[model samples]
Target: MITLKNVNVNELESAAQSCDFILPIEQTAVWASYQATIEGRKPWGCFIIQQDEKPLAFISLIDFETHGYHYVRSMHGPAWLEHPTQELETQVLQALATQLKQADKNLVFMRVDTWYDNLAVPVLSTVPYNQTVIISLEGGYEEILKRMKTRGRRDVRKAMRECPATCMDETERAYNDFSEYYEVMVDTGKRDGFVPAPLSDYTDMLGALGKDHCRVFAARVDERVVGWSIITMHGPVAVRYYAAMRSDAMHMFVTDRLLYAECCMLYDLGVTHYDLMGIGNDFAPSLKGLNVFKTKFSTEIIPVAAGRDIPLRPVYYKALTTAKKLRKVLKH
Candidate 1:
């Protein structure tokens, strides 16, 4: 029988390390702590699932509320410790939904963010992009460069040689330098047609995650910041969660150099995988512009499982869905 047991962060982290499972940064304890810093979000719990006393998977969840409806979200989990089959995933989700509902009467649903592939279940809200580019950081810096596309390699070299931009780890000075990064982010969002998150969101994230798990890399020309990338690390994986560059500095290829330098730094820290986060695909065409930039760093695009919302209260969930649709229509 499959059972979900509550565990602490250290226990869960240790299990993942012992099993050699790559725990996503979003599912880490640090991420839960970061979520706690955000309003309307709370660290629910960390859990380990077992089948007949053998550990199967681990997940950390955060509780959130939307329009007065409470829900718990598991981001990039449950990370399986053993080889997972569809049957196992189905069983696990079913069991998790039931258990979570029993634990919190106010929770209307549970959102399971995908880390697996081809989940045969209905998803109310899908991930922004179900596919992403992952670069293996196993080999040395030169070997890592060899895996990049020709354009990527040339851009990095040219950015280093011709551009006066210098990239360095600025995590220690993240507070002092964050204003510059945020200014660039706001400009990038305006240029890209998206709204950037509030300043406190990024600041709280950096403060909560700290320097050990999060690093801020900045590319500067003449001592002025031109680009920035925020990387989050957990176990053997490092994810580039946020990146932005000044519109005026685009010609210098600062971002290209910044990411390459970040990858090298991660590799040196014993990180095995560098996730460039989401990329545009046929299903998520809105993000296609990201493909031109992110794909240059890696040769392969990885398809992962998408998120699913398992409703515990059917009537309430239906009402919530209708209200959400109405809001969208009203906005338009």
Candidate 2:
């Protein structure tokens, strides 16, 4: 029997660090790395899948009142990837829905853009809200790069020639994008209204992910860091979770160069694809340039569905959504 319940930070650690279904996105380090960065998080429903009292799957749920929806992150495989079948998936999804349905009424529905490939469910993109990207590692690094359009290689080379950089290996004493890497991100986020998670979130990550799958790359001029990239590994994918560069760094193509270097490193490590986390082409007009840039290297666009929401109590869902909307207007 699969029993579901809320998990603590320690329990999250167990699910994230396990060897069976271990992946970077699920790693406590990767999640905590973005701690202070995102806001409006609810912690009650980070559900763990257990079979016979042993954890076998892990998934997180967030109740977002702005849209009156619940977002499900990393919703598969607290167990071995091969463990969940079509029937079990249905059961698990239903079970997860039951948990969220009990929450406030504001939750209109559940939108689950899970870790599973966009291809896994062909019709998912047709849903109300969704975003995702596909990656390729089928060929070795050289081959993948060769597959790139000319501009892709050109930006990479240009960045390399001008960027000052090196890898802060995961084991390198201690450093973080939230602290050591804050400047570049700050400059960029301030340009918008974005804020990252607090610093303490990353402190928890260092202990959880260990040194094997996390890294921070800083682009510096002389001794000054102009930009940095924080990335984590999950299975065969090396995801670029956060990145930004200073005015000079951006012009010098330092940020792009850093990513190119990561691509090469990932290739050497036998990792196949480098996921440039996301480029909200649909919502972030300011990022149109980046969306265009990422396309130069990516072979295809993978659409991810919105995280699904199901409130345990219909009334609570209504109230939550109303409160959320009111709060948004007040802030504005």
Candidate 3:
């Protein structure tokens, strides 16, 4: 029989590192702290799945309430030490459901966006999904650069020679220039036609992640911040969690140069893998431009598992689904 035990944040983080999972920034305790501190979403629930008292997997989740129902979400996790068999995976899911329902009588569902793609599940995903590019930082700088596409290498060299932007890491300081970063992100969103998160979210992120797990960098030209990158590290992997470059910076290729420099910097700091997180899959036409830019730097396109929403209260789940559909239709 599978059992789930509640774990503290440190235990959760340690398990993730020990397992060497390709955890997204969202899945870390750093992110949980940020969500709690900034978004008022607490207390974080970390669970360890066990069989006969031996730990099998670790999962960190958060509680969210909508329309008078509470739910749990685990982003890109329950990472297993060894890949679990299909039967074990299903058993774990059922255990979680029984445990969560017992803990919170109002719990309606549990949604998990897993890291392992092949893990089979009984239900389809209720969340949007995207593919991401992973670049191994295994070798030296030259070797790493050599692994990029020829066009990417050319662009990096050209950008390095021509752009001449200054890079600054502000990980040690509180992110006071979030307004400036948000401004650039807004401009980028407008040009790219995607909505940007509010400035406060970034402020919370910086505050929560702090210097140890997070690095905020800026590319400056003429003393103005033209591009920014918010990078987060978990275990040996680092993700470019959020980045934005002004349109003018794009013209001069400052964005490319800054990104290359940052990757090198992270490599030197002992990060073994870097993710240019979230590119469009074959299904997303809108992600073409973004995909083209990121794919140039990637050695591999990683497939994350499909998200699954397991309903504790089937009637409420059906009602919520119908409500969401109706809302979308009415808005349109």
Candidate 4:
């Protein structure tokens, strides 16, 4: 029988370090703490899924509510320690949902971001794009540049020659410049037709992750900050979490230089892979521009598995789903 054994946050971190596959930042304990800082979210502790005392996977759950209906979510996880077939995944998820329901009668469903190309089980919603670009940082800075497309290489070189400087700041003092970065993000959202998260969200993320694992890189021209990016490190990999630039500075290609510098810095820090995050997939047509921009840095695109929601209370889950659809339609 499968059982969920609760563990402390430190235990979760230690387990993640020794896990077989790379765990997403969202699955980390630090991320759970960061989520707790956001309003209307709560950390439900970490757990180890075991069958007959043999450990299978570790997952950190976060509690969330939508339209007064509470649900549990595990983002980009149950970081499996060993490869499992689709049947195993389905069994584990079913056991997890059953265990979770027993623990919290209020939970209507369990949302999980599984690392599978497909699943036999039912899912409430399908992820449109599970693909992202990853750049290898193995062969040093010059080799890294050689791997990029011609346009990416040219832009980096040009920006390096023209920009005053590009640097990564991981010091505690760097938090002081967050307001300036938030301003750029606000402008970026307006220009891109998306809403920016509150400044506190970003600030809390940096704080929760701490300076050793997270940092900000900025590109400047004549002492003025033109572009900036936030990166988080885990084991041998680093992820580019967020980035924004002053719209007028697009011609300067500061973003290109900024990311190049960040790559060099991560390589120097012993990171083997740099994940540029999501890009356009067939389902997400709106991300085409993002695909064009991110793919310039690396030709390699990795496809990940989609997320699934296992509903325990079918009636409430159906009601919640219908309400969400109605809300989206009303907004449109």
Candidate 1 lDDT tens digits, 1-332: 99998987767888877777767878777787889888999988888888997889889888997667788888777877655787788788878877887888999888775544433235556545689899988888998889999888888888778777888888888866578789989999998888999988889989999888888989988888889988888778888889988899988777778888888888988988998978777757777878988898788999866666778887888887788689889999
What tens-digit string does per-residue lDDT give for candidate 2 at 47-166? 676667676666654433334344333332233334455566666666766666555434445555443422132221222223434356566756666766688877776766655565
**Candidate 4, which ten residues in sequence have the lowest lDDT sum?**
117-126
Query: Any runs in candidate 4 off by more than 4 Å, and if so which?
Result: 1-3, 16-22, 116-128, 162-165, 168-173
TM-score per prediction, in order, is 0.92, 0.66, 0.88, 0.89
Model 2 segments more than 4 A misplaced = 1-24, 27-92, 99-111, 114-129, 134-141, 162-178, 281-289, 330-332
Model 4 Cα lDDT, one tens digit per residue, 1-332? 77778887668777656655556777777788788888789997778777797778888889987567788888766877776778777778878877887889999887776655333234555444568899999999999999998888888888788866555554454576578778889989989998999998889888888876888887766666677888988878898989989888888767777889989988988999999977876745556778778998886888765557778788888887788789889999
Model 3 lDDT per residue over 38-122, tens place: 4435654888788997778878888876557677877766767777777778788878888888888877888875533332233
Who is ahead in TM-score, 1 or 3? 1
Best by lDDT: 1
Ten contiguous residues with the weakest lDDT in model 1: 114-123
lDDT of 1 at 8: 78
Q: Give stretches of model 1 more than 4 Å off.
A: 18-22, 115-127
Model 2 lDDT at residue 290: 57
Candidate with best TM-score: 1
Tell me the deviation in Å of residue 97 in model 1: 0.9
Deviation from native of the Cα of residue 83 in model 4, angstroms: 3.8
Task: Score candidate 1 by lDDT.
Answer: 0.82
